[model samples]
Target: MDRSSPAGNPLPAADRADGGREECASEVKAKLVGAKRWRRLRRLLAGVVVLGLTGWFALPWVMPWPAALSRPVPAGMRITDVHGTSLRRLLAGGMRAETPPKLPEIPKALVLATLAAEDHRFYRHGGIDPVAVARAARDGVSAGRRVSGASTITQQLVKLTVPRARTLRTKGLEMLTARRVEMIWSKDQILEQYLQRLDYGNLHLGPAAAAAGYFGKPLADCSLAECAFLAGLPQSPSRLNPWRHADRAVKRQQWVLNRLGVLGWADADSLARARAEPLKLRRHYGFFMAPHFVDLLLSSLPETSRAGGENLTTTLDLDIQRTAERAVASHLARLAGKNVTQAAVVVLENSTGNVLALIGSRDYGAADGGQVNGAVARRSPGSALKP
Candidate 1:
């Protein structure tokens, strides 16, 4: 054909037409692929926008931001000796009081130990730690078990203040609330409140009560070792209680010290010294000298006052309370052979009608209804009431 002469080569019209058709087919295929890519990109963008919108609007409803970060501190009757020194706390309905020492008054060692044990990044993170969470998730997946916790100090504090069921929804709420708590409270303030509100075993709530209950020392007076020991209690308070399981408690304390060492808060020498330091704990029943008197005082308080963290000062004398307890025990011991099993004593000031001492039972440690307040028990005074 004339096409061959133009190019100086032999060519057929059918072949030329076939080549054009092939090129057109390729273009059509490319356009189809491009359309598919555009559709996929559009879908991805739409999904992201929808997710963003959902999170932005749904978060508030899920978390429901609080007006204030203030939580109810556990309140109890802080009965003292006649000379005004703290004798024992009478918890309201067995609830420990949240008597946190002032932040300045709390020992620095204790604060550091607590931070090391509970949340190493307490000062750095803003409520939630994505890195920790991711690591925890990875570890859990690798181990084929959920072994670690990713909750920050703020998140733990939120959980404590606002108890909820353990679920994905609750976790989402906790994350949101923790962020809100961070916004409302300073880091130091949040820490102080957390320490004060934390529960220790044996009905000891807060650092101050825990210090006194476990070590028989004031919060500021706790040694580094003791501080570490106390700092570890909040994790599993009942299981690791020093009174019940001293060895386990010591092990947990060592774990805390190791954490501190890793965090550069303590040196090898210091950690060793702390480990060697023996804990001289003054363990006793939850109720100390004036169990009944404390119970009575707690019962007498208004519900609002008890829940609002009010402290009660009573006329009960610690020394007299001890004496009464001893006398009751002695009389009961003597009467044991005569089938007399229980006794109660109530000593009062005649002039002011103030209760000076109250012995609820012969032995509050005894298993036979020891917790029952004999002083308040309903009894018929057969001949004694005749007068």
Candidate 2:
């Protein structure tokens, strides 16, 4: 080979060696950069987790905001008809009570039964119950999912009042609201309002209404078994309904009764007997006392009208209400299962919205209001629920 051909121009050995060293250095630097980036991300995630735990455990204080500035608009319930109603019904001194009021005062027994059943420690605990949450967490882990509810009534109130898109962020907001609601309302106030306004609590509507609608008596009159049935409805309103799923509803009712038994409000034998009995729904689902009128009335109203109001009685006649329900139930014998299984019957006085016979469900014990249409919805399709 020629010792020096210009075309060959062999590079110096030093130059080749320097090029190799530079490539090695670049690779080393790339690895170091990646390690640092990974550490930074881990730190960011850690910070988020720490903040959530702090809020959850510490249950940090929430500053009060004015009701006007608060989230929800006013709660409204509109009454349609008013013929024979004593809008001027007297109070203690033969005076009329407040108009557009809340449900009749909660019964002491219903209150006691709920307390005995739902939260024995409700009186003892502040906003959050570490023990209950821990138990629920254990249950969730055991079930391999979040099936248990660790929320207290206070927590539920927070969710109900604070309207937010459901998300992690919204959940945080709910906790924040719950903490604040705890500060503002007393335990009794919270409990009363919760039951009175509880959505899905019953077919006739709020708890007081539900007690009245179901037992055909006042909240004060709920039997131990009946109250157990009502209390259990909140957990899974649709599934464990005493009216439809007499069995499942009985199961849930038993849970409440069991709790009551544990709390000393009831005896084991009483609870067992109640559990074994079938739900005796006073009226057909959604039938109330007057089936045809209710069907006609609900069909006449618009969607906006379902909005509830206190003292909004209908013009239904109790005697006539029974007749209509019997007619339908008798006519649909094959549907006895489906009728009691799922129904919504609301009977009203034709002239007044004063519900003469409001049977929100067939198996008032099990009906989901929405489920029963025993007489079926029988309303106009595509038309609003109440106009």
Evaluated with TM-score, which candidate comes out highest? 1
Decoy 2 TM-score against native = 0.51
Off by over 4 Å in 1: 1-62, 66-69, 81-83, 285-307, 315-387
After TM-score superposition, what is the CA distance of residue 198 in candidate 2 from its true location, in Å?
Answer: 1.7
Give one digit per residue, the lDDT tens place, for model 2 in 96-125: 112212424655545666676556677677
The residue-level lDDT of candidate 1 at 374 comes to: 86
Give the distance in Å from residue 332's predicted Cα in candidate 2 to where it truly belongs: 26
lDDT of 1 at 13: 83
Model 2 misplaced regions, further than 4 Å = 1-104, 163-168, 200-202, 267-278, 284-387
TM-score against native, each model: 0.69, 0.51
Whole-model lDDT values for every prediction: 0.80, 0.58
Query: Whose lDDT is greatest here?
Result: 1
